[model samples]
Each structure stands twice: as C-alpha cells, then as structure tokens.
Target: MNTETSEIQGSCHCGTVRFQVRLSEGLMTARRCDCSYCRMRGAVVVTASLRDFDLISGEEALSLYQFNTHIAKHYFCSRCGIYTHHQRRSDPHQLGINASCLNGVSPFDFEEIPVNDGVNHPSDRVSRGGSEVVGVLRFVPSNR
Candidate 1:
C-alpha cells in the first residue's frame, strides 16, 4: 500500500513519557492484534522504524514487560500505567506505537482495522532457520 511520511508526537497518560515517531505512511497501516496479550490490552497500533522513534523525556518513568517468546518489548509509563509502544518481534525493524497516544488522534477515527493472528505466530510452526507464513490480517469493522 502507498503511504505518506508523517511525523506525529505522543505521550503516555499524565505526560510522564513523551515521544515522537515518523510513520512511513501516516496511519494507513493502523491495526489491532488478536493474541491473548493484545486482546486484553486492546490497543490500536501503527508501525514506525526504530530509528524514527524518539523518546523525548521521562525515561525514568517508563517500565517494561515481556512475555511468551520474549521477542517483543512492551514499554509503559509507571506513573499513569499507559502503554506507549512496543518493539515488535514479528518485524524487528519496526515498533508498534499506540494509536491512541498520538496527539489529537482517536481510535474511533478508524473505520476498520485489520486484526493480526498473533496467537498462531508463524515462528512456532516454521523451522528455526526458516521463515513461516503469517497469514493476512482480516478486515474487522468496529461496532462503535
């Protein structure tokens, strides 16, 4: 899909953690994941290259969480307990930024978002040295 480069600023609730990220194509790639962890967190995310993400402040206020394969790194604010973003295992080159955190952006703005099948993450079935197919995300409309 074609995308336009956009720079967006964001922060955790209470502004304890601040950041700015340059998205390759704005929010055209916004989505949700269906893994158990994601289902509970219920965040809508968009991709950003690691180098494009800048933590402007509040490093001491940030906390981390990892699980399962431990490939992804989740970062949140200890002060407000808001999820800011995560280093994605599926795409090591990109991080998933919380869509709700972007300044003036709302999750309700998305008409529909794709849902990734993180529960059946391809790495589990594929050979260690080989790659597996991560099936396409389905178009799931929001009921709101």
Candidate 2:
C-alpha cells in the first residue's frame, strides 16, 4: 500500500458533504465509465482504499443510495444532494472518488483512462440491464 503524503479536500455544492483524501501521485489514476449515470454526470473516478479517505464531518449529513445489485453504496449529501463518492461494488476494498469533486485537479491528467463496463459487468450474476461492451475511448486528451 502506498502511503499518502498530501491531502485533497472536496465538498458538495451545498457544503454538506465535506471530506478529504490523503493524496498520492498513484491515486491520480482516473477512469471513466459509460454507464447511464456516469455518462450523464461525466465522472472520472479515482479510487482510494477506504483507509485513504476520511469523512471528517457530516456522517449524518450524508445519505446512502443503492441500486441494482445493491453492492455499491452511492453516498450523497442529504443537504446539498450531491453524489460525492461511492463504495465500489466491483472492489469492496476501495472507495471510488468522483474526480470532479477533487479541488484544483484537472481531468486532463487522467485522459485516455480505460473505461470499465459497469452496465455489463461479468460478475453481475443477475442482469439488471442489457449487455453492451463498449470500447474505451479517450474522453479528453492531455493537450486539450
């Protein structure tokens, strides 16, 4: 496990879901998804093992929403109604932080990241949606 040396802070629009992550260069690896919600939100995700993320204040300020297999727990600020981060269903040990939520970090650094097919994950024993394996594409180039 990589030790975190710097801290990155983030909050929802309403200032309710305040949290911090111990940042490291390794954590900057971002990935996008073509799943319905992901595409709509234009989220680039950076994963941190649960130990790296801290919910400083606002445990009660947040609400949990789950769908489909109910393996992933999407956490949103109840006050501001912002989806800040989620406990990943694919990897139970990691927390998926929305790249957009990180202050001062550009998605450009994470360009050309591989997009995983959450909509048709093979581990999904029960199909909630149609299977469509989409090829990963560079959503944004570094120069752009």
Candidate 3:
C-alpha cells in the first residue's frame, strides 16, 4: 500500500455500501486472525480508529454480526454480503478494516501476514496481555 496516502475509499462487492478511512498504521498493520469466524471469513485487516472511519453511504445496506463474547461487531453489506470492517474486541476504540474492501487493494497483495491467535485472545488471558501472533500466512503466486 502507499504510505503517502493515509486516507482511502472503500466499498462492498455490490457497491451498496461505501466508506472512507484513515489507516492507523498504513498497510504495515495488515493481519489475519485464526478465530473460527476469521478463519472462515478469511479477510486480511488493518487497523483504524473509530473516529477515523466514516460511513459515506448505504447505512441501511449495512448488516452487523456478533457472536461468542460479542465484544467485536462484524459488519458486512446486506446487498452483496461482503465483509467490510469490524469493531475490535480487544480495543473497542479501534476498527479493523478489511483490506480487500479498500479500493485498489486485495488480501493477496500481502505476501506475509501475521496470524493472531484469536482462539487464545489476549483479553481472556490471565494478565490481559497483548496480541499473540501464532504464525504467518504467505501467498506465493505461481508463474502463469
């Protein structure tokens, strides 16, 4: 991603939902989670403060889903069913923007993304520690 551009535009698959965000740490913060939901959804995410995220359109087309502790709120487009972003359960003040939803970006764009151990969430730890990145997800494109 371009470090020079802090703010970027995003939308769902069907374009029913659109938004703008200022990434907290550019694309360097991109990561994946090993939690059940994340494993299935399979989206690489980057961080952004809640105040830095702006929902430009499709308020009615947005649908939210939450489970388990329900601290994190996952959002997707109701029209196209594309996961857009989510409120971080570890830090409610921050939102995790699906990197693929960002314009001109794709999950495969990152070669190696740290995979967090959501199964052993830091908040649930005895000392309430920080994120535990278990491993890395790598994407190597073959010659076509």
List, residue by residue over 3-121, the lDDT tens digit for candidate 1: 35379899998998999999867998788887889889989898999999999999999999999888999999999999999998887788999988988877877767777767777
C-alpha lDDT score of every prediction, in listed order = 0.83, 0.70, 0.92
Residue 79, model 3, lDDT: 86
**lDDT: which candidate is best?**
3
1-144, model 3: which lDDT tens digit per residue? 564456999999999899999998888899999999999999999999999999999999999999999999999999889999999999999999999999999888888999999999888996868988899999999999
Error of 2 at 64 (Å): 1.2
- 1 or 2, greater by TM-score: 1
- Each candidate structure's TM-score, on Cα atoms with residue i matched to residue i, is 0.84, 0.74, 0.96
Positional deviation of residue 37's Cα in model 1 after best superposition, in angstroms: 0.6
Return the candidate ranking by lDDT, descending: 3, 1, 2
Candidates in descending TM-score order? 3, 1, 2
Give the lDDT of residue 33 in candidate 3: 96
lDDT of 2 by residue, 7-57 (tens): 688877777677898643444456777766677767667777788898878
Candidate 2 segments whose C-alpha is farther than 4 A from its true place: 1-6, 23-27, 108-110, 125-144
* TM-score for candidate 2: 0.74
Candidate 3 C-alpha error for residue 44, in Å: 0.3
